[model samples]
Target: MSASETNSFRAGRIVQLLFGIAVAAAFMLPIVWLVAGSFRPGSEIFTSLDPLSIGTFIPPRPTLANFGSALGGAFRTGLINSIVVAACTVVVGLLVCAAAAFALSAMQWRGREVVFAIIVFSFLIPEEVVALPLSAIFAQGGLQNTYTALIVPFVGNGIVIFLMRQFFLAIPRSLIEAAQVDGAGWLRIFLQIFLPLSRPALIAAGVILFNAQWQAYLWPLLVTTRADMLLAPITLGLMVGEHTSDYGQIFAASTILSFIPAVVLLGFQRFFTDSVAMSGVKE
Candidate 1:
């Protein structure tokens, strides 16, 4: 290669590397601040934003005080409730949405497209718009403040159904046909064939559902008024109105809440990427 071309290529490579680093740092800064703030006391969190200072990037003297306060009493109960809600949602969504998606993808039925359109259209509706009616329904049914109130509303998830349907649509029809030729029914085919090949999409959908339920604020706040029924976001929010705000405990609670989603994504990050990418590649 000529020197000019070589120099140009080298410059582009350097530029790309710098841009990648910048993007990564942009995404990581909030998390870094969260961890740093969690370690620092309430005093350090309100540190001046002057450029000359080390800023809030690191704790001057890190302590476990924040974690101690966050992991007990109402906070602990909140965390457990959040976990239970998310777990049940993922499991129910997995089985139900998988079945719904399977029929939408692999079956030949009348009005399939029309049904699918209606289901997918629900995804566009804002959750806040439905929160009030849902609260009333739960209250009327005597489900309010019960785990059923938490689990039932989120179980019929449109996004999960749409995502799984899209993924299933990409599966080779020949596979389903062969299974049918071998005298396998739809249930047998789904259980013994399609589901086994859909690990990535299933994991990805679970991660999405789990994250949604965990980060939820308004819905939990609306339907569940009991203190013990609170989730992470609601718990953190109530801390603000405490007799006195402890930013340290607040930050710690936020950090723990944040960590669950991060760990969930990290746990299934590979599958999540593959599921999204493959869903777009239809045969």
Candidate 2:
């Protein structure tokens, strides 16, 4: 290529990199503001909002008091409750989704394509549409205010099943055939071979499951009226009373809530990306 063309290419690459960084910063700005506000007094949080300035994004006199308050009382219980619910859901959800994905992708049963299509269709349906009916059903079964109620609904996650199924479809069929030839049963093959080889996909699915349960607010609000069973988001909701609110504590809890999931996703980001890429490419 000519020197002019090479220079143009380098310039284009630099522009693209800068644009990407700008976009990422734009997205992160709110989170940064939230963290900043959390360290300031509740009254001072919105004080700089009249005309935005550096003070808007930076707490001049920062304190740990908000975090201290956030980590105590009902909010503390809510954090623990959310953690327990999300952890339990991830464990149960992975097994259920993996099995469903395996059956759909590996087995050549009747109506396999139809079943897969249905699963795809199910994920497309908004949770809000089903939340009311699910609440009624759970109420009838006397499962409200129980951890089982929270964990059970999330175990059969359609998106996780779809993700796992896509990953499973990318696996070589020769492995399944060879295992069968060696007199290995389907369960044995799945446990010993497929599960062991699908680490990236499993991590991706686990992350998805954990995030789903972690961010769950509407459903938890509808089902559990008890303060003890309050999830983090619901607890955050309660902090905003009609008469007054505590912005500092709110932001602190929000930061902690966002931080946990961000850490989880970042920690397994490579595996998540690999799983997504592999699922996209099929032989």
Candidate 3:
């Protein structure tokens, strides 16, 4: 390459790197502020308006009192509840969605397209629009104030089923035919053949479902009135506002709660990414 061309290419690379770093810093600024504020004194959270100002990146003295208060107070109960509810939702959702996806993809049942269409169409109905009627049903069914109230309604998500079905559809028909020739029953084929091949879809679905249920606020708040029945992290962080506007404790609880999903994602991120990539590979 000519000298001018080489210099131009180098300049382009520098510009791209600079732009990427600027965007990354922009996104990280809020998280940085939140972490820094969590360490600051309760009184200083709002008082120190310019946390990123010169020489203010680090606090003078960081204390764990906010974390202590958050854990000691109602925040703790809320966090536990959130975990339980989210776990239940994830388990139930995965099982139901996987089963439905398997049937739709692997079986030669009649009216399958119509059934799948109905499932997809249900996604158009907003949750808020149905909350009132759902609440009434929960009350009538004696599910109110119970963990069932938080979990049952979310057991079958349309998006999850659709995604799983799409993934399952991509699996080669030859694989299923081979399994059938081996005298594998539908259940056996699903468990041994389809499930193994559909791991990426499963992981993708699990991550999305888990995150959705983890951060769920409106449904839980509406269904359960009692504080003791509330879910984990989110509930705890929310109650922080009700109990008192303790920004320090609130930020601390939020920071800790935020880490739960982050930790989960970090642990399984590789699997999730690989699965997504494999899903795009045509058989």
Residue 181, candidate 2: Cα error in Å is: 2.3
Two-way lDDT contest, 1 vs 2, winner: 2
Q: Is candidate 1 or candidate 3 better by TM-score?
A: 1
lDDT of 1 by residue, 1-283 (tens): 9999999999999999999999998888878887888998977787657623566777778999999988975899899999999999999989998999999999999999999999999989999889999799889988878888888878778999998999999998999999889999999999988899889999988988898888888888878888988887887887786477888898999899888888888888899789988888766
- For residues 151-238, could you state the per-residue lDDT of candidate 2 as single tens digits? 8989998899988998999989999999999999989988998899899999999999999899988899989999999888999988
Task: Tally clashing residue pairs in candidate 2.
Answer: 0
- Output the number of the TM-score-best candidate: 2
**Best first by lDDT, ranked:** 2, 1, 3
Q: In model 3, where is the ten-residue run with the lowest total lDDT?
A: 233-242
Query: Which residue pairs come into collision in candidate 1?
Result: none
Q: Considering every candidate listed, which one attains the maximal lDDT?
A: 2
Q: Estimate each model's TM-score.
A: 0.93, 0.94, 0.91
lDDT of 2 at 75: 89
Question: Across residues 192-264, which tens digit of lDDT does each residue of candidate 3 receive?
Answer: 8888777767877887788888877778877887879977644654654545688888788888888899888
